[model samples]
Structures are given as structure tokens and as C-alpha cells.
Target: MSRTKLHLLVPLAALGALVFASLSYAQATVGTFYQQETFTGIESEFVCQPSPIGVVTNTVTESGHFVITDQGVHIRGTAIQDYRIDFADGTYLLSVSPSHFERTATSSVEVFTEAQQDRGTLYSADGQVIGIVSVFTLTHITWRDSNGNGVPDPGEFTSEVSQFRVTCP
Candidate 1:
């Protein structure tokens, strides 16, 4: 090979290796995932009374189709709330809100790794806090089976946390 051609080939080979290495090491988690909140008990001033049984609980469910990018994990999705309200009267309301929330994913740490942990804030369609107030940790990349139970539970995945609320209810 000519000297000039050899020099050019060497540089090209090095550049190719660099590109391949970077791509191989890139941390990219792009897929659809759900985020949810389980019935973590209720907080209200007015004690509800039911003739049969009084129950207070809330479930906040949200999901995202996220792409891990250099900027951040960009996600666009919605949240729907299914709740039951027990009135001070014997009347009980089993309601799925007429409204669902749409939100853009916000970030504290955009980078993703296996078992990466993060605590970040989320905003609803109307700019209300919908995620956990204290902290929301992705304990693992996805679902984790704890308590040695083969069946997956509600709080077993990244979707559900303890303190999540759709609004102050």
C-alpha cells in the first residue's frame, strides 16, 4: 500500500474502533414502562362512615414510552385515577375520575443503568404533583420479586410507590 493510503487507513481504523466502543458502552433503555401507585392508606380529616364497611384507598396509575437520549429519558404518557370515596353519610362513591392526566417526563438524573436509582418530581397535565412526595426510587431496572412470593405484587415494580397521590384528596 502507498504510504499516504496506509496513514489514512490507520486513522480510519482508529476512528471506527472509537465509535464501536462508545456505542457498545452506551446506556440506552428505550421502551414502554408503567408507573403506578398502590392503595397506601388514606389521609383525610372527615371520617367516612359506611353502613356496611368503610374503606379508604387510592390508586394512581401512570405509564410512559421512554427513550434514553443524551438529553434525558424523554417520556410522554398519561395517568388515570381509580378511586373510592366514602362519605360521612351512609353513601359511598365508587368513581373513576372523568379526567386522566397527561405529562412529560421530568428528570433529576436522565442517565440509566442496571438498577439505577432516582428520586424525581413529576407534574400532572395541569401542573400538579402526582408522584410520591417524599421519594420515588426505581429499586431495579424493572420488576423485582421480594418476600419470596412468585406472584408479582403491586409495589414490586418501578411503577408503584408509597406516597403517590393524584391530588390532595
Candidate 2:
């Protein structure tokens, strides 16, 4: 995974990267660090067939912490992202998603896990509730240094779990 892409998935990467850089030289030390921030932005996402493309105004509140120990680096965090999505038809969806994510890394292996759920009501241009929307996603990954070179070569990683579900009407 690209470290640069981390910001796209979650805001935790910015702080995590800084901490990881400093820890590269002090693997023997043990310490814990924490961070919290709120961010807002606009983006685009695919909703459903009726309104496949939607413009999203989002506000995300996140908190994360990381621990650097003799064994490895461990990080975990929680985020709540509130979104207001508008479509060309003047319909909209208001959603709030709460998610949890964690990562653990050692010399030989790395693990990542994430879970998120979103529930919302889709409204028409007249402000009447037209539908209900629910979405869930869960993902887990494990990467091992099979050759013991500490490099993540192909076939050394596995996506143990990856699931996404959406319900709408």
C-alpha cells in the first residue's frame, strides 16, 4: 500500500507517518503517542443506480493513537464521518458513519483491519423521505515476509476478509 494514499483512506496516516519516521532509528524504545483532529472537505462517490454519482460535503472527526514497542508498531483509531450527498436530480442523502481501524506491524508481518457502518435517509427535492440507505464494509489484511527479507514481495500478502454491502430503496 502506498503511504501517500493513506490520507485518502483515513486522516491518521499524516501523524502516523511522522511517528514512523522517527521510530525507524529507535526500535529499542517503547512509547505511545496520540492525536485528534477534525476535517471537512468535498468529494465524489458512487451511490447507487438511481444516482450513481453524487457530490459529497463531508465532515470527519477522528482520533488515533500509536504505540512503538520493542516488538513492533501498533496503531488504532476511530472516526465518525458525516456526509451530505446531493445528486443532479436534487435528491440527497444524509449519512453518518462510524468506523474503527487498526494496524500492527512487526519485522516479519503486518496486519490491518477496518469496519464501518452507515445508515441514512434519502430525501427527494421536496424534502420528503424517499428511501433508506444502509452500507457496511469490513476489511482485513495480513502481509508476511515469507522470504524473511523484510520486503513485501508479491504473494506475501493476503486479504483475509473484504466485504461490502449496500441496501437502498
Instruction: Give the number of colliding residue pairs in candidate 2.
Output: 0
Mark the regions of model 2 whose C-alpha exceeds 4 Å error after superposition. Answer: 1-45, 147-151
lDDT string, candidate 1, 1-169, tens digits: 0001122233333333443444555765556555566563433532222232434555656554544433333444444445554434434434342122222222222111211111223234354544431212121234445554644677755543222222211
TM-score of the candidate numbered 2? 0.75
lDDT of each: 0.36, 0.68
* TM-scores of the models, in the order given: 0.35, 0.75
Best by TM-score: 2
Please list all clashing residue pairs in model 1, or write none if there are none. 35-159, 36-159
- Candidate 2, 69-116: lDDT as tens digits: 556767777667777878889988888887888888777888988888
Clashes of 1: 2
Candidate 1 deviant stretches above 4 angstroms: 1-28, 35-37, 43-55, 98-169
